[model samples]
Target: MVTRDRCRGALLGLAVGDAMGAPTEGMTPEAIHAAHGRVEGFLHTQASGTDDTEYAVLCAQGLLAHGRRLTSNDVAAVWTRAVLSQDGGFHGAGFSEMGAIANLRAGVAPPVSGNDNHESWSDGAAMRVAPIGVLCAGDPVEAARLAREDAQVSHAADGIYGAQAIAAAVARALVTDDHTEVIAAGLAAVPEDTWTARLLRQALDVASHAAGMAEAERELYRRIPLFHYPWPDSAPEAVALAFGLFAAAEGAFVPSVVSAVNIGRDSDTIAAMAGAMAGALHGETAIPRAWRTKVRQVSGVCVTATAGTDLVDLADALYEASQGNEEYENAT
Candidate 1:
């Protein structure tokens, strides 16, 4: 039951959220308010997607090339050829990706490459995993498994768990309208004792009790204990915040993404994750026309090869690929 509308919504939502949130990425909620009151729409005249959108396209391409047979080695090979082989440095890429690239340059491989990287716990993997969910629609466990295959190339521990959670959530969302079920699928994908699980639960609790977006933001800031590190790209934090805001907005596309953007701290990634889930839940019609139009094509800022890539066409291609795989699996 994975429709093309929902697929389009998922990818377009990711791009819209990435572009809309880019301007206020590092600023606090108060700073965002001071700069621009409650960013319900695009900030700039011509909003452009950041690393989040490009990396997601990369993930989609990986899924397109390998389907359910995708492996960590396949992911590494894609990274080497599509990413590392390019002359220009990774524009606005995350620390974990940079570390993984360095490892690849040194002839090291995944699991080791990811485990040895210092920034393996960042949200890099989670940001680009929505495509796994798209390909594994209605199958959260399968989505989580595929997500791990991709995450192991550049992430470990909480990073992998966060990617699994988002992928599972999106997979569930693609088949069901129940936001609670989507959240449950995400939680089920991760271990109960892990930091990602704990934070996700805490974020949901905060979202459930809060009266409005403002109160939810404040409560999230108070309850979620961001690490003392200088950077604000922790996988657990970003994923938890995105899910919490999705809950707060009751899975509405615009509100979910806007809430994540307004909450600040890794805004682009958080908003992109929230937007992906919300878009899947509601379908393409739920997203505003203007936002959809703006995100139809990527800027290729991070991954230059993704420049001029039309997300609408990509989504259709992904849906077609998924159907082919499903047919193959049924016949087998």
Candidate 2:
């Protein structure tokens, strides 16, 4: 049988890491230090959520609330509205956050603009794709396909592709027995259509060698690390994130996430996206206890774990979704 615990672990692990990363969102390294005096571990309270995981949960809720299956149009409509709902407005990377917003800026009507760049790439989609993967665990292809549907509202190019990677990883995790093979397959599933894919592979190779967040970011960026432009890359921050997680895939889950978030410009999004990928590989129990203690995504009316879908329950649902009534739950 598929372990509900694993799925739960993956989902909660994701949410927890998302929350942990949230506190530092949009802060420069210096700013984060000034605010929290260098967060060595979880701070024991809600640091506030960002638009990353919030967008995903809200996007899914919007679909369920509307009682609609995912369509590019539907995804785009909800995504645009969601971005507009941002409290102070997105200060950075909104156009690149989801390619559709750029069209909106150019005066495309909401409904009409939804399909303009249906296939454009952005990382907005990649960060919140875990649930789709969790729910569609039975068929990896279907998982990837559904995840693309999830991302259709916002992500395109490498962003959409990154969602495909996470979904496929979680889907395979539901059905696999081997840990090494599971992560290996998860990395494999991330596509080679762009530089992000190439970097992911490079990261997987050097994941263990890096000493800390700064080094990992440099290795992932293939940059010569320095105080100035330590993480320069040709790829977008979202694209760099996909590989950053892969490069730092070893050791403690929370630390891995913290390191990735600490090193990069888009701290929360990178940690959140990478956390989902890592959680899918390792499960909830794999996450550190201290990080969970300090996160806000674990509690709140707005971000409640689905009533029957807390970490363990969510994992069980995916396992059942994949296995159906089969005793062994093995499709292969």
Candidate 3:
């Protein structure tokens, strides 16, 4: 059931939002409306991606190019190089980018932190995190573990939790074919203490009547309380976006992603996360054909809309990886 198309579908679904939302990443809901008007077109597609999904592709490209596997060292290298130029897919630098650049400059991978846990909760990790999820394949624990590594490369705390949630959800997609289960699995990944967790809790309470993204967005804004964060949602829009993605389950990929983007704070990253998750859940056909076709043609350097490697590839690889890993462990 996990076709090659679906493999790529998951990441591409994430990328569709990433590339489309790149231009609008930082703008507020009102600002987005004032500038873009109605927030309809592929407004974010004209340029490259921001830090979220771009870094995700970088890791994927690196893993694929270097061989079908990645070590922490390989991750550091790709992330290091990703920041040096736009090729890495980072739109702008964040804590992860800084650590990556620092490590590369030091001619080594960054040291893993210990003892005190870092508390950064940016959406960057969530934005660019689908590859980890796709590769996790039916294993939420492994997905969360991989997501944590991917998040800490720059983000900490909530960042790690967000990526874990998304990754676990994507990984779980390979197990059951149900959409509800997919959403449930994603929610289960994050803990109760974190912002992502709190947001999911709020969304779950309201998901039944929240109906369309518009109503869901308002409810989410009120509950998640983005006003408290210095950089808008500081938690980024991951929570609202996730809410919209779940609420907009009946809609197409573009609509789902757009809902996530327009719901306000962290629009781009939220859209990217939603897009990635929805894309994986629905597969390539889930995306709007016209939008995808346009994106493929308009893509900058690293991004691709179709005919590129995707989550399906990642999924199959994960299955193979699981077999190999199991064999290796048994041998040892």
Candidate 1 or 2, higher lDDT? 1
Alpha-carbon TM-score of each model against the true structure: 0.96, 0.69, 0.78
Model 2 stretches with alpha carbons more than 4 Å out: 26-38, 59-69, 74-120, 175-183, 190-193, 208-218, 221-243, 293-332
Each candidate: how many clashes? 0, 12, 11
Candidate 3, position 282, lDDT: 73
Computed on alpha carbons, the lDDT of every model, listed in order, comes to 0.88, 0.55, 0.60
- Best candidate, lDDT: 1
Worst 10 residues of 2 by lDDT: 300-309
Error of 1 at 69 (Å): 0.5
For model 1 the local lDDT of residue 142 reads 96
Candidate 1 to truth, TM? 0.96
Candidate that scores best on TM-score: 1
lDDT of 3 by residue, 1-332 (tens): 55545656676676667667766656766787888776765763354445555467665554444332555566666655544443344225555455545545656443352112233566656766676666566777777776776566656677667778887877766555676777777778888676677777666676556766677666765666466655643443465457445555543566678767676666667777777777776777877775555443223233322123333444455434444443322211
